[model samples]
Target: NATAKAELGRATWKLLHTMASRYPVIPTQDERAAMKQWIFLLSRLYPCGECAEHFQQMLKEHPPQTSSRAALSDWSCSVHNIVNARLGKKEFDCRTLSDVYKCGC
Candidate 1:
């Protein structure tokens, strides 16, 4: 079960980061709103209940930063780092996100 959860988490993070990497450089207002709404829905619908609750709280505190692709990617990295810290894992270098999460799009 733990292995499954970990795999799910990794897949989810990959999806999130890839989406952020491919986000519009200058998204329209409606696009930004949609991105934020999608994030909220993700928090609500994540497979792991405990992880979903934690993500919801993080959203309450940090909210989604959808101003630009970079902002959303950086916000996601920061939030991922927060979870890493909680898990006693090493934090990722946020500056290298573009290099790390190339969506090839």
Candidate 2:
């Protein structure tokens, strides 16, 4: 139902953002390609059909920034803000991203 979809979206975004927060500072070419591929695969495999469609379109428009950890994290926050705006949700404060998303893993 709607609650399940919303929960899925929350979990997905948390995972993505946390991954970005932990990404290599200066990723290797292969690492960069892997992150890009992972995002595309996620868009295709996401459970919610409508959300997946919107995510694919956003990916097409913004693409992923895998050059560095900071770049990837910033890109993630920006894209998430876009989605939040679309959903009438409050935008996250990107300045505190690093503090907010420590994986401790």
What TM-score, computed on C-alpha atoms, does each candidate reach? 0.97, 0.97
- Model 2 bad stretches (over 4 Å): none
lDDT of 1 by residue, 1-105 (tens): 899999999999999999999999999999999999999999999999999999999999998999999899999999999999999999899988988898775
**Candidate 1: pairs in clash:** none
Which whole-number lDDT from 0 to 100 does residue 65 have in model 2? 96
Q: Write the per-residue lDDT of candidate 2 for residues 1-105, one digit (tens) a residue.
A: 999998998899899999999999999999999999999999999999999999999999999999999999999999999999999999899999988898988
Which residues of candidate 1, in runs, are more than 4 Å off?
Answer: none
How high is the lDDT of residue 81 in model 2? 99
Clashes of 2: 0
Each model's lDDT comes to: 0.95, 0.95
Relative to the true structure, candidate 1 reaches a TM of 0.97
| TM accuracy, model 2 | 0.97
